[model samples]
Target: MATVAGVAVEGGHWIGGERVSSPTTFDDVSPIDEKVIAEISRGGEREARAAVEAAGKAFPSWSRTSREERARLLHAIADGVEKRLDQLAIVETTDNGALLRSHLRGVMPRVAHNFRFFADWLLTLGHEDFETRGHRNHVSWDPAGVCALITPWNAPLMLATWKIAPALAAGNTVVLKPAEWTPLTASLLADITAQAGLPDGVFNVVQGYGAEAGAALVADPGVRRVSFTGSVPTARHISTAAAANLTPLSLELGGKSPLLVFADSDLDLAVDLAVEQYDNAGQVCLSAVRLLVEESVAEEFTARFVAKASALNQGDPRDLATDIGPQIHRRQFERIDGFVQRARAEGATALIGGGPNTDLGGLYYRPTLFTGVAAGSEIVNEEVFGPVLTLQTFRTEEQAVEMANSTRFGLAATLATGSEERAARVSERLVAGTVWVNCFFVRDLKAPFGGSRQSGVGREGGDWSFDFYCDLKNTVTAPWEK
Candidate 1:
């Protein structure tokens, strides 16, 4: 068997259920060792057009597929992913350096679950019919033609499935563009879907840089809907390109999500929840990057939070014991470190680590903590996208909510309080798309997930996702009296 690091994995574009070559190719380098592990086909506008055209060709028949047929195919995909979970986990760990244990336990399972969730949920869809004087109205859903799915590198396979499964389940053909930084598992997924018997041209992938393939995929007139999960800047660009053709979009963008800890709450639990920022090395868009503590317990909470954060084990992702791993790439590592240094220069005191851990090797950064982060400072406002947390204190519940709502990102937030009334009140006051009280990162497939404001545009789970991928249509019949 070929090991993840040693295998010379080579992938080309999967167009119309067949592998196609590109004139140029790029190397998939492992972030853990900064070594080339695979060679990937470099697609551009030409490839994007081919993929979109192929999806468009497939759309008519695919959209006509029965709900039961789609559901069965989705279930088959889930089973395929389950069978290959261990292999995919290792490939992802090698590709992006997310901890192997976390990838296997947390991320890869979700890849299968996403497909299963959508497959099962499709059966429960509810439609309504209306009766009027001499007329009857029936409502139905129709696939919105070809869709473009662009996913980021942080949790590539899981996030990709989050979009792909629902799109397919809703009967939309897709042209997926995985992030340039991580394409191995995505390539693997195309093969899995093929093995699962997804029809030709129904699902396609074009692997290349965002500037080349990503831009073309979104801008293509053939793509009727676009779903993207990445940075705010990239979303802005995609938003512009997509707007020209009036393509509908589902954007799951960045977050500077906040965690509020109250004096009446358990400080130890709060600390443990806040430490989740270091998960995936804080590359997650919904990671609680900001901490807002009640003034009554601010000092004590900060002390415990810093202590626990300082103790997290950071090293090789292959090690099951390693709690954290390297940042995705050298540029990301340096960008995060630059943010920390700039924050320090702006008078924010680093309560713990503030620089890269060269001793740990290969683009690793020490999990940094900061206090005295001024409101509207670069560090507090902008996403560091690393294992860094900034602390702020508020005296009143109103103040905590205000601070949490201050960022352009309204992705998600968490609060801890003893009073149920307070939890209810704070949860309502917060401007985030999802608010967690006394817990962190708790998610239900039934709950719609997305952000408000600049964080994102549309929801992506449950019926919301089903709706996003299809256009709701209504038909009316009138008696011959007219």
Candidate 2:
């Protein structure tokens, strides 16, 4: 078996279906122990430009390929992903510090499923037709030209494929810039795409820092569309660059989402989900950072949430028993600590777990829960992006709804109530892209997913994604004279 740290990874950019070496290389250190895991080839703006040129050259043929051919290729890629699922998952775990168990059960399966879903969807999609008095109107969806896909480190391959699969399925050539924090899995994905016989330049990866490589990809004139998943600051930068050429963009940015628990809700289930908000060490964008409980049950729910959160096992990501792993890097761990300490300074009470776990070293922070958080405190409004949760109480249904929608982010929300009517009403009232009635992080690929306000700009899954990646052309023609 090829272990993540044991394997010698070639970290070069994949361009024109070939491994392109760079003049420089950077060490990819594992967040688990800060050990140099692999030496990755580092490319800069020059490399980014070359990648876009390659993708531009390949677009015409790939776009003209038959739908059946495209679907066949996508399925083959999915099969390739499945063949080495375990190894790939291990790579992701080591690179990002997600537990191996989570990769096996959740992340890895979703990566393969994304490809399959897009491929299957292509088969069912049909062109639109309309008839008029003197003419027949038909709508044809054509692939957008070159596309730039920039994915974050927390869930690299999965998020990248959320754009890649749909872009490729729509016949658009893509150049992906995986976050510098975790580039191993993205490189591995490039290898799998090659094995599956994906044509040269259809899918390319440029691995380097976001400032140089990522900006270059987004700013390239030849790239027509950009799909990015990362911080709001970065998205704003990309938006500025993309605007130069009026490039279309799909931005899935940050979130400080809320999870509301009504008095009539299932306390046990809500408590369990409250703990899970810290999943991925709380680096998730849709993490329920603000826990809103009905005033009547606030105390009880806070106690239960704190106890369950403190009980989560944190250790080496390789251990299947480890429920929480280290942060993506040391800097992020420190940033999270600053957030916690500032919250305390701002008068928030740390109910349980507020500091780093020195026992495990690396970048591990114990799951922290806070109560008595001010309405507009830093911890309540800002995205900690760590294993931290803040609690607030609401007296009425209107207050719950208002507090839940208070943040500038509108990415996702969770509401736990026994009554279906209450669930429907509250879910509708909350301003988020996806709202869970009684569950957290339950996703349906067929549904549209993205946020409003500062959280994101466009949808990413299913038909919404297909529409984003293609240009809809309407053609009207008169019947034959005969």
Q: Name the top lDDT candidate.
A: 1
lDDT for model 2, please: 0.89
Evaluate model 1: give its TM-score.
0.97
Question: RMSD, each candidate, Å?
Answer: 1.7, 1.4
For residues 1-482, write the lDDT of model 2, one tens digit per residue: 12365554568899989889789888888898888787777888989999999999999999999998999999999999899888888888889999899899888889999999999998877676888997889987799999999999998888888889999999999999889989998888888999998999999999899998999989999999999998899899999999999999999989999999999999999998788898999999999888899999988887787677767888998999999999998889899999999988888888888888878766999888888788888888888899898888999999999999888999999988999999988988899999988888889789999999999998977788888999988899999888
Q: Which stretches of candidate 2 lie over 4 Å from their true place?
A: 1-3
The C-alpha stretches of model 1 lying farther than 4 A from their native spots are 1-3, 6-8, 479-482
- Tens-digit per-residue lDDT, 327-356, candidate 1: 999899889989998998989998888988
What are the lDDT figures for the candidates, one per model? 0.90, 0.89
